[model samples]
Target chain A: MKRISCDSSSIIALSSNCLMWVLDKFETEFIIPFYVKKEIIDTPLKGKKYSFEAMKHGLLIGNTLKVKETDPILRDKIIKLSNTLLSHKGKPIEIIQYGEADAIALAIKEDVSTLLVDEKNTRLLIEDLEGLKKVIERRTGRDFEINKTSAQELNKLLKGLKIIRSTELIAVAIKRGFFDWPYPRADIVKNALTALKFSGCAISSKEINETVDILTQTH
Target chain B: MKFALDALNFFKKTDTKLLRNLSDKILIDGFIEKNNELINLSIVVHSLSKICEKDYYKKDGVYWKTFVDKIQANLEEVASDKAQVIILEKIIVELDNHFGRYKNNVLHRSKIRKGSTLYAWGVSLTLASQMVKIPEIELMKQIGRTKIVDEEAQIKTISERLKDAEEIL
Candidate 1:
């Protein structure tokens, strides 16, 4: 089974869409950090009933979706790194939360296959293609090609960790027959991606359209 | 202790006059004493950002919004000072990104998955302060997470608490 660690946003996104039940069907082991679990399960807030219920359902799923505690030393290091991680403008802004820091730490320590997160800042900090472009532009005052050298540098910075969003998960779920409906296959996939977007998946419309195109073609 | 107390009090009332006075005192002290003003400026900007955001949603008034903009303008002017430009620009950019995150109801939708605006703001400030070398405990205390007298209590690690939370499964 593919081992995956998730942040709170992805979990809530999956749960809010009523597609969390398909998590087990995908043959992936979902691991959540303790802080992420508390964000969803322990603390109950108004206007967040869907996330609360999703967390309850996640708990009911048992070992397949385990909640793991991060190693203290690793967590501290990740927190420090995340705090020091500069933005596109090279400012040391602490954008990642404890839960995100813990999730990344657990992934690094345990060697998880992927980390599921939906926050834009964390995503940009990790991959940062646009940010890399901006950096280049700021330094040279001109556009530069994103060649292998720049890509390698970014990969090294991100530590070669595979990051996926809830939108991609939804795409995979649709591919695996989790979103079968009476409507046309294209419509079903489009609607599924749109639903994820509306539920705060942080996917762009262009990405959604591309994912829909690929899924439809594969089908 | 006084600075921490004043900061804590500022969060409660979110008075602009209080913030202005505090920033002025810190700036002057930093200039005369040759101490770093980056941390203090970051804290002030962070607090102002939160207050402006809260008022944006709560009162829907133009007063707080314009006041925050004016403060940013003033900060930009201060940034023109040769020595302070870089750090102050970083702080201003961070503040801009912080507000930009909620642009166009994106954060409004995400609030369902994340916690309320209050919770998000609290966490952001806590982490941002940590980046600036402010103690997390102090920020938490200022945010009313811990009582003033209980400041010496050891905060439990998340992993240690998770050991007990495992029983929830």
Candidate 2:
């Protein structure tokens, strides 16, 4: 079966928006590694505010989304590569961590070409390193020493991995009629995408409008 | 660590200005030493300085003195060892015990804020989330609401990513 490795950000966003049902309906398998399970399910289960949401996520793994194990060695290598890719004032800026690396490793292990994630860091690193450099420099207003060697190595490992955020995921789903929101007459796609943006999907106003424009054009 | 002693002296003087400076120093030390406790402490200390600087935190009666006394006692007595996650949770909890005005769980909110600060300083979302022990979703929203993680800086167009999402699953 075809598979897409998923990280915690996408899962949490989907769960918050009551969109986990789409995982079960899609023909492609969504794999969540053990470390991601610990993040989105186990850890949150022990917390106060999002425990119930974590339970809802746990149920998804049990019933629909498959839980898989990742290569710990690969995960550690990716984390080191990502963190060491840039330096600030002679210190290596610690970038990506365990949860994101776990999904990357799982996708590499499974030979999957795509990763489902919402956060920008790992995605920007994979999609465009130069772009990420510009973004970081613009944000911090400080010069970061980019280790070209480390960037090349990390890019070699992460080559061809595509990122799909929850906003895009839901937009496609709504366009495909996946999100069955009850209020039928409401602009379901637009409304759902807006909710996703506010609820932690890392989408911009322009991106939201662009997506809504394309997705709603057929309607 | 000298930070412990610095924290102690600041507690004695109750100097909100110096405390804010100390917080900045501790945050820089956090990046250098990879110390989670120091980062959390820096956040809470920042919060404490903000609180102390404001007149709103002042109480009219002896209750204010008691509140200050209580905070001073708690902070002064925090041993250098075993200062892992306790600094963040403990300080926030102590404040909650005294100030019933906060609308939300200050500890949780601080963690998200800390994660945002770290991300804006060039830490990855996942790394910042892991350091502050917050869900990436929460931290992402916190940072997303800010202009620090500028979307326009990204190279790919939204439609390209949208096409990938539409085609993949």
Give the top-scoring candidate (TM-score).
2
Candidate 2 residue runs with Cα over 4 Å from true position? A179-186, B1-29, B53-56, B60-63, B66-92, B101-107, B144-152
Q: Candidate 2, which CAPRI tier? A: acceptable
lDDT of 1 by residue, A1-23 (tens): 56788877676667666777767
lDDT of 2 by residue, A50-167 (tens): 7987887777785677888889999999988888887778787777888889999999998998999877777778888777777667655667788988999998999888888877
Error of 1 at A42 (Å): 1.1
DockQ of each: 0.06, 0.48
- Against the reference, the lDDT scores of all candidates come to 0.51, 0.74
Clashing pairs in 1: none
Clashing pairs in 2: none
- Following a full C-alpha superposition, what root-mean-square deviation does model 1 have from the true structure? 14.6
User: How does model 1 fare in lDDT?
Assistant: 0.51
TM-score of 1: 0.53
